[model samples]
Target: MSNPAARPWRETKEGIALDVRLTPRGGRDALDGVETLADGRAVLKARVRAAPTEGEANTALIRLLAQEFGLPRSQVTLASGATARLKTIALSGNAAAIATMLETRLGAGRQTG
Candidate 1:
């Protein structure tokens, strides 16, 4: 069985590659299950309260990620997933160090590449 706290998602391409399990209209926007990428990327899983409509979810996602990483909202960008549960987010600056922090804090495994 998979560890409940173990994140299967990862970070790549100087960005975060996630296997998102979206729950639209959730109680609140949040980020969790941060991990490391071997290519020096920061990976994390997120949850948002906005519905998946008119880019609402996307906006919420960026806001949540920015808040989680303590970066500006513009620092987080949706690389894909205009209308999908799973999405890729690109993060900028000190990515490797951030990934290390996520891995240590969230207890998620790291990506080799």
Candidate 2:
């Protein structure tokens, strides 16, 4: 399997509005979406699967973010849109650091929620 990294996405001051393609339960957690790069370039793609449920998908998202950023689950939080398909996740520490982590650790795999 390829490392869940390398894919790139741009970061913003108000946190990232990820173009996520969520796979509700029985899916996989990988970076799958189109996002502008930090350098203002248009790069697209990454995939993550963790069914949209009552905090289930959010939990999985936290885990994935932690794994990618090498941070603890407590560090990541769903800043907004928990019930909606499009959600906003806030990464503690540094936004740029988290963005780098996502760019590096985004690929196909099974991530439990």
Candidate 3:
């Protein structure tokens, strides 16, 4: 199988672009794992307890990602999909370091469809 983490994010001059699949109003806020879609695209799966109303889930997701990657909340921004389950988040930092951190935390074997 392809490395899910490798496919979900890409390095850019400013930072890294992350593809995320979010589940709002989940029991708790947490990183579930990686998920491969039917189209073979991979995304990082995360859940937030916050409801999907008035950007609450979006804010929670940003906070969670910032905390996970040790970046300031200001450094993490929603790049796309503001009101959708799939979102693209841009993190302003070293792409390589961010990728390494995510790989270490999520692991290669942890993937769900």
User: Model 3, poorest ten-residue lDDT window?
Assistant: 1-10
Per-model C-alpha lDDT, please? 0.62, 0.53, 0.86
Of 1 and 3, which scores higher on TM-score?
A: 3
Candidate 1, 1-113: lDDT as tens digits: 23424554355756544444445687888655544445444445567889899999888888876776577876678777778876776666565666665555555543222
Where model 3 places Cα greater than 4 Å from the true spot, the runs are 1-6
Tens digit of per-residue lDDT, candidate 3, span 1-113: 44544467778898888899999999999987888888877889999999999999999999999898788999899999999999999988888888787677766567887
**Clash count per candidate:** 0, 19, 0
In model 3, residue pairs whose N, Cα or C atoms come closer than 3 Å (at least 3 residues apart or on different chains), thus clashing, are none
Q: Which candidate has the top score in TM-score?
A: 3
Clashing pairs in 1: none
lDDT of 2: 0.53
How well is each residue in 26-64 modelled by candidate 2, as lDDT tens digits?
Answer: 367655444444554333333356656667776876687
Output the worst ten-in-a-row residue range by lDDT, candidate 1. 1-10
Candidate 1 Cα lDDT to native: 0.62
State how far residue 29 of model 3 sits from its true place (Å). Answer: 0.4
